[model samples]
Target: MSDPLFEEDEVPTWIFTFADLMSLLLVFFILMYSLSKMTETTLESALSSIQIALSSNGANINQSPRFYSGGGSKLIAPETPQLADTQDLTFSEEPIDTEEREQVNEIANDIANKMVSSNLSNAVSVFEDGEKITIRVDGQTLFESGEAQLSYEAEFIFNKLIDIFNRYPEYSISIQGHTDNIPINTVRYPSNWELSAIRATTALRYFLEAGFRPERMTATGYADSIPLVRNDSPENRAINRRAEFVLQKDPDLQKLYGK
Candidate 1:
């Protein structure tokens, strides 16, 4: 009877303390996970996304993005352009596949043979540096002194060349026009630059008309910058004045050519 009915002890606040502790632990783990993958997160995410898209699981996600996004049956995607680089590239000092190398050589040889058999020996010459090939054409035969108009003989040669290019046009074609040191001045064109450009355009137009792939071809005018020999003599200058149709070599092979 010592007033026991009204007596009570102070209870410990354990429930609130435990909840706060649990919340702190959860936050610490989330932060650790984020820091661990910080450097490579975006890169890994992009690659994983691409891989998943290519897999069977992608079909489900792509068909119903809401399933993956999990936002009230709504799809979530960035509105801005994604910053990711995923380009296929190859790096090799030497030929990794001999079959590809052999095919290139065979193609070049076939072209060289065609040039010789078509009675274009004096006007055209084929040269091969490793797997790269180039067909040199005499501009003097195609142009009249300072003119860029194609002669009848040039038409025949180009006609045949067009057929060849249309058939196997996997190689890059460079049409570079060169000229002697002689200055040129005409009504429509002036200087070697304009004249050379006209010649390149003339040839390029012919190729395009003959159904050659435009992506693999380029038209350029070299003027008298690159000379085959000293322009001291008339014969040497004659050789310098030429138009070259070259097939490009692989960049790697070109670097290691004289090495």
Candidate 2:
């Protein structure tokens, strides 16, 4: 027999459990939302506190995701790529030779040491990628204001560089000139492109005069298109205006050297 005070629809025992579950879920979601709103430092502190509390109670924590460090940028396409062929293709591997790598490293080290020894560190910087190495020279150090001609001091610097290149015949050289975003409308150089090109050509001529093989050398200009940094600040503008001596990759040369 049913209790006299209780109706058929009177609050069921299961309804209390359901309400408690819903309340717990709501609180959990609220805590998660609050965690998201925390600053990096605050989030770290909270995680540390939680970890300490768990450890004191004999709970084992395996690993935590590293939130501070970030990987390098990867190129991402906006949409799925359309391939003309759906067949699997044969792939080949030809890693750079160990000897070639050593040679490049030696050259870079020698150049860096020479620059430092001569107190030209302020005007020059050396950078290396896997396939190539580049020696970048500050534009202001090489030429006068709005002039393409290499200065006397610049000539001295090039002479030192030439001594280094004379040893490495296998590597092809490229003189790349870069200019700031400033507009130039002179009769000689109507645009930044012309100015940049002439500067590169001027440097090329220097190497040629010093007995470098013309076939192994080339010149190119990048007119404010590929700046190292934004041209918003004067310091950044100065950095953007520069020249680079790049050791180019040549498959034929590599093959000749038994790569």
Candidate 3:
């Protein structure tokens, strides 16, 4: 038997622990909501930065141009583009005058020296002027008189040319065929026009087969026209009937002209 005043009992403290846990959960949700609002503000600031880059003030846009040093629009006092858009951005550029001409002349001289070393100076002439690099192939060397067919010696010349052209893959070449006033009507080919066109086409085909890019090569026929000589005498007529290989300028350069 126990005394009534000495009887004891235990009460659980777990109920208070449960209430503290619920309070912590409520605090967590409130913190999360505040962070979400801050995230939206940060996103808006980032978008504003991009928008500023796209839409600039009209006054600064005109007075300054976008010169990209590190692919960034570094504006100067004056800048313009011949064609400028989001997809295709082109900048207006100045023409390369005397300096560019000198450089091309130097390159042509070097090429001529190389051909000289290879012992190909007679049939082929390589030179550069103000506008283009010219390669003049004499008809006397490439073909027989009044004929479009390539001579046996022309094959050797063509092989040497292939070696030279393969090295500089960046250049674009155009082969032009010219003839004298002497007309031709053969079974295989009819008329001087057809003969010249065929010869140019044949030369172009050789270039393509020898691993040249088709886009970089062009063949043109000029029959009894565009004569270097007066075509009056036999010697002049012989000189007039010739083939020329011309190196054209880069097409992208048009963007500089703004036309």
Candidate 4:
């Protein structure tokens, strides 16, 4: 019983639901396309902002309706304080690579063998940390008590060491002088600092005179600030008073070689 006034091609109730679904799908595709068009940096920034916003407790979503009255959504992201460009955030030393560590250990073992062969094992010792190789020589072997002059045996040892340095000219070397806790006030050395510095300089000068590159070498003094023992006994004090040679690894080379 169709009414004569009714149109034959009337719209179905399902049409309205279908139209709503299509509209939602279209909006979703538009959003996807917009996100795809964003640059990588912008995308990363947006993601970082979202992460920060989610993690922070300061986010305020209870703002007045006037905040989003302009038909645009609000993304509340609290600005984090950033370090200044001039501030150096990387102040720590780089880790040593396996190849560099092996190289350092090889050098240390070779030097130890040389000292043993020359019957100077008691005077000198070799150790390797992951980053560097340290060759420590007893102060008495190189200098008399309260004196900075190198002995005849010390000169021979330095010559041999210079030969080793020549084979590896690329290595950067540091010579450090350390002293026992005993205080000294001499006419030449007013304090332990002066004595320690002079001793380090004396060792550095020998290398420089042997034609080692000035730029590749450094000299420093610890002045009882870095001691091997507590200086509570004569044996411990003797161990504390020594000269050290440390060979540093090049950071760039380690990276290039894949540590």
Candidate 5:
């Protein structure tokens, strides 16, 4: 009655389908278990490794990751890159001049003396790096909590800075404002970015009013993105919130003005 090629004990076609279903379920459970064992840091590290591999293979990838807020449908985009508010000037490969290096050192010394004489040695610091100098002033000395308006004490310090900046006309100055990790939301400042920006521009305006050349200076806000220390403690947060005056020798300006 049966065909000659057919076997009486042959496997049924339904068995293959059942086996496939069981295999798929096993794989799904295995994947779920593996994921459950992975910590957040491990997952992030794996992702970073994948990104690096893809980058090495010449794949176009966005470095920033998308962030989502808890219980909110809104997407928090990464901060855009901001350029320094300075003129686009060409620089050569030549080494910094000896006199220029000395001048920068002298400026640092002068700033240090001024801070000590003004009894602000603790609240301010002066640093020199080759032909660049930075004067860092504590945020508390400049402005009140969550406020961009300069305090009365800030004027005296600003006056001293203006005198020094005027004396060194060949230097290009950048006034940078920085904040801590604390969130700020107000009618005027909806975020730390706006607050930091206003603070920087306020200082810039003061300098401009003091007869500093507008073309030689720039103002920018870092908005807590560049921190001096971790914001885990109040003391560290206080240190992170500050303003900096970065000065660099402008060779073109020096040549033009014969300084």
Candidate 6:
């Protein structure tokens, strides 16, 4: 007969092995189910976090992340959404008065014809916008570099402009001076502002001496503030350095000039 202790200790080794195998199977199934339930958003978030971490570590990783599902299917991360290009979009401008625009165009045409006849076409340009007309003169054509004094060519241009002003007593003139981004410092012109202001005033004085009503004119200086184009090149900078004679219809001035 067997001892009582040995008999009590006796057990099936196979049963323990079977229980261990079942436990492993249960854990494997749970892991598979969890992996299958993972959403695209959750995976994408995890990928982004990983990318940020890699980037912080100075790792150059350009490839997008890919995940595997329980069914052995590959899931690639979604690409970032691109922003809309504002440059391609169209914007509406202020509506222009038809009759006023026509008048301004007529004045522009007259100026253009005069410029061609005077051989000053290349030095000047005329633009008509809404109720106003602009006669833009290249700065180099009127004055030397960094100088406010008018050149001989400026006198000729001013004479032609005065003739036009005599005819258009209904319009008010605004002389605006512009400059390039280059800095200037001198006893006469402390900065571009002074230079520009003096240049505008000089032109105004010429107009005043030509018997134009001073009340109908103004002088302004905008030093490298308003530019026609990007001041990145020599040509563009030259274009930006200009003086503009802006004419607008002024009813009060019309009466003042006996229009």
Top candidate, metric lDDT? 6
Which of 2 and 3 is the better model by lDDT?
2
Q: Residue-wise lDDT of candidate 3 within 1-259, one digit each (tens)?
A: 8897887866579978999999999999998987677765455554544433432211112111122212222221212212214222111244558876786677678778877887878767886655567788877788765566678887888887787676555567899898765545556556668778888888898888888878788998887756665555556667767788877465643343332
What's the lDDT for candidate 1?
0.67
Ranked by lDDT, the better of candidates 3 and 4 is: 4
Tens digits of lDDT, candidate 2, 82-187: 2213121111134667776677677788888989998999999987654577899999889876778899889989988888787666788999998776555567
Candidate 6 lDDT, 173-246, residue by residue in tens: 99999887655656777777988999999999999998988888999998877767666655776887899998
Candidate 4 lDDT over 22-117, as tens digits, reads 999999999999988998666655655553343211232222222322112333332222322321211225676788778877887888898899
Models, CA RMSD each:
26.3, 22.4, 27.7, 26.0, 18.2, 23.9
Residue 145 local lDDT, model 1:
70
Q: What is the C-alpha lDDT profile of model 1 across 60-167, one tens digit per residue?
A: 223222243332222233122222122211122454457666766787778778888987888888765444566888887887776778999899989878877655
lDDT per residue (tens digit) for residues 1-259 in model 5: 9797786787999999999999999999999999999976667666654543343112222223222221122322223333323322223245678887787788889989988998889888998776678899999889987788899989988988888888788889999999876556567787779888999999999998888778888999988787776666567778878999998878787986798
What C-alpha lDDT values do all the predictions have? 0.67, 0.73, 0.65, 0.72, 0.76, 0.76
Whichever of 2 and 3 has more TM-score, that candidate is 2
Comparing 1 with 5 on lDDT, the higher-scoring candidate is 5
* Model 5 poorest ten-residue lDDT run: 56-65
Score residue 27 of candidate 1 by CA lDDT: 100
Candidate 2 structure lDDT: 0.73
TM-score of each: 0.56, 0.60, 0.57, 0.60, 0.63, 0.63
Error of 1 at 249 (Å): 7.1
